[model samples]
Target: MTAQSAHLDDELNLKALSFHAQPRPGKIGTLVTKPAATQQDLALAYTPGVAEPVRRIHTDPDLAYAYTNKGNLVAVITDGTAVLGLGNVGPLAGKPVMEGKAVLFKRFADIDCFDIEVQAETPEAFIETVVRIAPTFGGINLEDIAAPHCFEIEQALIDELDIPVFHDDQHGTAIILAAGLLNALELQGKTLEEAQIVILGAGAAGIASARLLLALGAHRDHLLCVDRQGVIHLGRPDLNPYKFGVAVETNKRTLTEAMQGADVFIGLSGPDLVTPEMIASMAPRPIVFALSNPVPEIRPAAALAVRSDLVMATGRSDYPNQVNNVLGFPFIFRGALDVRASRINQAMRIAAVEALRDLAREPVPQAVLDAYGLNALSFGPDYIIPKPFDPRLRERVAGAVAQTAIASGVARLPLSD
Candidate 1:
């Protein structure tokens, strides 16, 4: 790195440290929602009046939603195995990230969250802990656990808990990706069923994206997943069950080979793993979502320089068409909580995808434009996904998800409007 860029990085690190430190030791704390100032109020809040509601809740368990904060609360739980790019930092080190997620839950959707960091030796131990405490909140948001284990933990929680259990690292990434990919394909005059798509990662986000894409009608044979072992095809002997799910009988054995004549490329791997040659080798009007953060697999400038017909996106906010998790998780939880949904099922996820995809096609609102300091943005090659600050996101995505949940028979309560 240049001296100037290195200096900037140091400055940013200091600023971020101060931002989290000076305001308080951490980013989040609880606020009491009920009055407890006066003697009478204390009696009502704790002993006498609280006992009446406790009795009602004991008689009818659903009454807890009416008497407490359970309807609006979520637990953001993590084991720190895959905390951002800093993998396996441990539970305590991962606390800041979980708290940041809580901040987003409140800021974006007005949902309350308690960030819980678990120190469990085994996946089964962690699962048992969450299952034991599942009654306190309306929903659960699993974060930052590493793959294979993450897949197992999430499925177990979903099966055991009645409330929605979501791993944002997996489904949140998939939901936004699907929305952006659908729009990009439409602009390129391609369809998901026929697009030759290559995803260069086999971890949680990569595997989940593959599954959601398949559910959305991408032909299984048309998709390829590449890990460190190169392309995960049927011939690979070391494939795990998750990798095996997306594995196909293809002669392509490497990322370069997989990219040949491909219609789309999605990189969830580390920086600079993709080359200009790979970008150039793709079909005309290629869609490239190099979604690795801080640095993409191929830098946007380099990729665009290679192919002007490219429709590119990354996980960076400075770039147009950012495929961000912030655009999905908050609103998704909002919708699920509103209807007391049993789970965040496939139909609800597809509804969120369609909501986001369709929203991008509309005219960009002035508020959103102002938030990004852009004079205008239109739905096209450069702008394939809705901006994170788009106010309509809560109503559009959340409403669709809630309605779909009710229609799909997963909701415990009907939406009043």
Candidate 2:
């Protein structure tokens, strides 16, 4: 690393540890919901009173929602194989990330969380672990686990569990990116069907994004998924089953080759992999989502310097069109939990995307402008997605997802009388 970069890393470590250590050793903790001051209150909270509700719930399992915090409680789980850019740091090392997610869950949606880190040997082991503890939570959020395994674990959990089992690293990023892409394309006078797209990083986020976009009417032939080696094509023997399903038979060999005349570029890969020449090679008014976190595939300034006509987004908060998953997961789960949804289905996801798309096109709130320290903001290239702190996200996104769950018949607690 450069001297400046190394210095920044050191400062980040020092300040981060200090802040986490200050008031407490962690970012989150539990608070009691009921009063237990007197002897009578204690008796009702435990012993005989607690047993009556326990017996009732034993007879009718669904009564847990009425007796406890299960309705609003979500579990943030990780095995630590893919914690941020720090890969495979182990479950214990991933606790801070899970705690950060818990903080976001509470801060954004008033959801209660129990962050759990599992030290499992394999995918089956992890799946078994989560399933064994499933009854304690209203929903399960699988996080930071590596790919192929993440896909398998999530599918199994969703198949076996009644409550929502969302893998945020995949779908959260997909939902937010889809919303931003819709607005970005609309502004550029482009459509998903006709847009030629290239995606770097065929991991969880990348694969999920390709499929979600396809579900949204993006042409199969118009997109290509690429990893470290090159394009995931039909002839590539190394392609995973997920990649094989999305792969196209194409002659493009490298990212540079794929970018040539492409209408959209998405990077969930490493930083600095993209160059000005590659950005310049894309079609006029291109849409770019360099969503690699901590740093992006290309800095917005560098990409914009190549083509001022393009709309660009990054994973950084400092950028304008940040594809932050915080904009989706919290409220999406809020909706799912509110209606006692069995799962977060495709219709619910599309609803969130549409809500975010419509929200971006409307006038920006003064609170949002102040939050970002901007004097004024409008619907344009610079603002294609709603900021995570925007108050409307809770109401709009949650309501949309909840309504879709109800409409789709996945909700057990019917909202309508």
Candidate 3:
């Protein structure tokens, strides 16, 4: 193998080995909210004063937000069926990603998060288990679960629980992706209705992304969705309910026929699926988001070389225009939890994308640049998002979401200035 190939292999191996180390399975720590100094302080904090507040909350449940930590705590729950790029390593192996998500919640939004891994054998049982513990949290963040099942699980949780329930893999990816596409379309001077978007995956992220794009006025008739068995045309013999719904909404001209003049190629499929020839076949200046993890559906070099005018993005952090969902989830949930939102409605999600896109349009903050150990930050085709350490994310993105949620009538409690 070439030196470059060897380096890639080594990096992949190191990542795999690191994940395999079973030393620290999950992370949960306590934070002191009230001072315990004397015996009098302990009595007030624990028994008598606490009971008073509990009594008040029982009479007027809205007082819980004022008295307890429930207003700021989010449950980052997972079943470990779809752990990032690893894909179904089981519940124990998935704990690390859930914990990492909790860390991001604290770092980005000032929200307290608890990571819960349910080792339940079935999706229905898992959903039931989460619902039982739902009241303890202000919001629910479902992560890395597989599709179809994830769709049902999120729907059930949202119906049963009063707090917001978000599945990051599906909606988070969808939201960031929509933001990027909106910006990319502006850069190319095109509108969603005028574009022919061909999606190369029909899983959780793909379906959610397609739905969000369509809701943004992207022409459903002009969209085509393709899965492993090739394009999902209407009346296909073997297609699941979710895939079938996607098939019916998209590919109005039929999948095989629509690819002939497609304006955008979005691949949430497995690695190395799109060839140089496929990209060459696209319309001039075709926008592509090859958003498969670790490795994209089409490698950047090959895609760019074949169509120099093409705008491309991926799920990997190292690449330009990464469509990673981190830009959305941490702050989205933060905003929801901050204002005590009843649910994450479509309006809130659209507001989040708008905030992210607005942030991308501005010159990156000097503080964020300094945190990255750089002197300056600039917005360009290559730099469309703030790095994870960007301090402005909480105030900018989360605040926007909270404001929008209030306006959209989903917030149960508003934050004090």
Best by TM-score: 1
Among these predictions, the greatest lDDT belongs to 1
| Candidate 2 runs further than 4 Å off | 1-6
Ranking by lDDT: 1, 2, 3
For all predictions, the C-alpha RMSD in Å is: 0.9, 1.3, 2.8
Worst 10 residues of 2 by lDDT: 408-417
Judged by lDDT against the true structure, how good is candidate 2?
Answer: 0.94
Better of 2 and 3 by lDDT: 2
C-alpha lDDT score of every prediction, in listed order:
0.95, 0.94, 0.83
- Itemize residue pairs with steric clashes in candidate 2: none
How well does each candidate superpose onto the true structure, as a TM-score? 0.99, 0.98, 0.91
Measured on C-alpha atoms, candidate 3 has an lDDT of 0.83
Q: Give per-residue CA lDDT, model 2, range 1-417, as digits (tens).
A: 589989998999999999989887999987988899999998999987899999999999999999999999999999999999999999999999999999999999999999999999999999999999999999999999999899999999999999999999999999999999999999999999999999999989999999999999999998998899998889888877888989998998899999999999999989899999999999999999999888899988899898999999999987788899999999999999999999999999999999999999888899998988999988899999999889999999999999999999999886542
Tens-place lDDT per residue, model 1, 1-417, is: 579979998999999999999867899888998787899999999887789999999999999999999999999999999998888999999999999999999999999999999999899999999999999999999999999999999999999999999999999999999999999999999999999999998899999999999999999999999999999989888988999989999898989999999999998878999999999999999999999987899999999999999899999988889999999999999999999999999999999999999999999999998998989899998899999889999999999999999999999888876
Error of 1 at 35 (Å): 2.2
TM-score of 3: 0.91
How far in Å is the alpha carbon of 137 misplaced in model 3? 0.3
Query: How would you encode candidate 3's per-residue C-alpha lDDT over 1-417 as one tens digit per residue?
Result: 479989998999887767646465345577888889989999999887789998999999888788888888999988899888788888878887888888878876778988899998888999999989987888999998998899999999999989999998889989998888888877777888899899988889989988899888988677788887777777688988888777754334433455566888888888887788888888877888989887798889998888888788888777778887778888998888878889999998998888888888887777777766777666655666556666777788889989988999988777666
